[model samples]
Target chain A: MSVVELARPIEKARATPKGPRRRVTAWHRWLSPLALLVVWQIASATGLLPERLLAAPADIASTAVELTQAGTLPTAIGVSLQRVLIGFLVGGTAGIVLALVAGLSRAGENAVDPIMQALRALPFFGLIPLFILWFGIGEEPKILLVALAVSFPLYLNTFSGIRGVDGKLAEVATTLKLSRGQLIRHIVLPGALPQTLVGLRQALGVAWLALIVAEQVNATTGLGYMINDAREFLRTDVIVVGLLVYSALGLATDAIVRLLERRALAWRRGFLA
Target chain B: MATRLSGVARAFGDRVVLDSLDLVLGDGEFTALLGRSGSGKSTLLRALAGLDHEVTGTIDVTGSVAVAFQEPRLVPWKRLLANITLGLDAPVTKAKEALAEVGLAERADAWPLTLSGGEAQRASLARALVREPELLLLDEPFSALDALTRITVHQLVLELWARHRPAVLLVTHDVDEALLLADRVLVLDEGRIAHDVSITAGRPRHREDPELVALRTTLLAALGVSPEGRS
Candidate 1:
């Protein structure tokens, strides 16, 4: 509306102009996977692997279809996933509570920390025998094993999270006359959340791995069992099928955690990512 | 309520920081505690805040305390509103009101990372005020700021203290800052009170009054620095 104002140097006001758009989009994200599939197909067609010994993609695909038709794949995944959920919820909650107790009280830390540290250092997979012996080979042992595998990471992370909180923040908490519970709930928990979440995410992956390892010998209705049953007749196709299912499931779980992390660690986006 | 620190003694390893320190803070009085670097002024403030339990002394105060540290120490994960409300049992609405009081209403939902140092310190001040503390403690609350920001915060703290009427104990190494904000200045040297000078200047004190200039010159000399043109 005013020629003189329009003629003023807008460059000084804005300083930096927006740059050109990038050619990159997410359309090419699948290229590497597609290329890998092509390579697998080529290898199968070229007879690089023995047809019976190593199942071709087509054989594995047909096996997958058969398993799908028989409702075995869904059932197996259901059992595995159910076990994971129960174990993670129970284990994660207990770990956080214990961590808080130990972190807050010097006596509790003295009594519990060394034991927990030793337990955490022990090879979790090696404890399967003791768990079986103690709890029998029922679903109890399997579930408990998954829970045991998860507890250490969650507890350690939560403990460190509590310890790592800034002392100045605690001083402020005291200055305001915050009650013990109030201080832990508001200051300690949020301050240690990122580390705790990291622990929970790590524990989740460990739970899945532990569940699969648990399912190996006697499990009749999980992906591990499916693969074990396949190995009786040497059906590597079904083994590959099991491996694929497990990988996809793990990827989905990790993506869910990462989505939660984006919300949890939204503040750390620039620094962390 | 009055606060008294009687025969307060603190030592770190072999070095003595505060030796039988005796002081009384009158009701609603503003005192600036001055000392050299590593002079344990912060330790004294922390002891007053009930943070240093190992220190041997009877620190008697009739009401609750609130401390504003040199660093804002806001929770990085929490929003400005949440950080200010962290130690309270009150509802979120009350926290929002406190943030609004500090002119940070719009930044209520913004994370602490987005705040400037001055803004963060203001939020820290808001945090202290939210508790309505009877005694306020500050340790070099504006040391990290430029002159303008420092003066702004000094005025803000003075205004808040004037309105809230809490006994304030502020620790700083800056002589000019001591003159600008304090009712009385307690100078510490070699772990002892070297001087306790009263500022006779009236309320809303001018920064460069003759008395302030005289006191500033004296404090600088006590701090072992030549006036104005020291190399």
Candidate 2:
């Protein structure tokens, strides 16, 4: 006999929609940050907040402008960005390849999954000393550290994503007589994308964290080195500028991924409806 | 025969779903399979579609086959037109033609999730029909719709079947549906055909047709259900 149709009462409930929510005005999101900046400027003007403890927003901005003029801040940012790009590419590629290998075959999964899971259990920071000892405090250790940090989250997420594809959809592929490559390209990968994007966002965050920690341990370039140099000279203004740059970079990368998600998953209509 | 299966047997860990079952369909014939749930209707359909490989049978199919399951099973990530033409060697215009045939020509660009149940099933039917298979398997494709929508879909399927002229195996348990749609109806019981009843009633048969009503009674009785309460 035919199966009973599942009643989606939730769709009906959603149709009887409520009034539109109160929209946040254009300036609302920026208001809090602007208010904090004004407070910082006032404190610094009154000399109530010491520069050694916390540099004022104005001083930090001036320091950033001076550094950019001297080419220090721009050079550091360029170097840091380059490192992140290289590390992310290497790690992301490896993660995707490994995920496909494990996701597609029982033999590949049996051979690879356990070792990766064991390695994943090790804290990323714990590898610092070993990395330094092996790679000798050079660019190798720093980039490798970032790559390693980026790989695990992407690998886990991609594997789970591939696994999470609907079996019924796969059956459709088989009934359609789709070849293995066609099945992978048309069905499996597209099905895995929503989960894989979740992994990507997480990996990007972890990548920045790893880069920060790696550069802090030993580096002569990049944002972390600039912060380290500022600490040595007690120039809290330069340090605050470096911190803000990091935050801005983080925000920018996150925004990029969110945009990608919107474009790629336009077909998804769940709560966005 | 457009499709033939002989001594087909399928089991899951010793629980036989289909046991030495044999079925044949003539070219351009509309056949309906009726069975209670778990009586192996889907199992047989899957075996016929070559989706169930572990079946022990010698099956001979004359040409390509396409299937529409109870669910629409359209790829959620694909547009309706793309879903219809997926893996088919047909051009975009053909997909448009199939959509027009299914009365969903305007919805070709819409997402599958955006369509209601009946509309999505129409899209699914379009997907199957675009292939122009010699055998078309319908695993209760209209069972999910409301009664009114089901009648509309029934009419649509009859129209499409008349145009395509593919040998159809429509798996359903509704006696009136079988009387309305199929030239021949088979009742599956205990993993075998318990009754093979052919309806000679004229085309466009109504639910209230005297011959159809009698056939429904006989079909219901063969299904081991009393016609008194149900009719």
Q: Evaluate model 2 with DockQ and give the value.
A: 0.64
Candidate no. 1 TM-score: 0.88
lDDT of 1 at B171: 96
Worst 10 residues of 1 chain A by lDDT: A16-25
What tens-digit string does per-residue lDDT give for candidate 2 at A98-151?
A: 998999899989987998899999998999999999989878888888899889
User: Considering every candidate listed, which one attains the maximal TM-score?
Assistant: 2
Candidate 2 lDDT tens digits, B1-231: 568889989899979888898878899999999998889998899888888879997899999999999999999999999898788887899999999998999998898888999999999889889999899999999889999999999999999999999999999978788889999999988888888888888878888888888888888888878888862
- Cα displacement (angstroms), candidate 1, residue B194, comes to 1.3
Expressed as tens digits, the lDDT of each residue in B3-47 for candidate 1 is 988889899999989888888898899999988898888889888
Q: Candidates' lDDT values, in order?
A: 0.83, 0.89
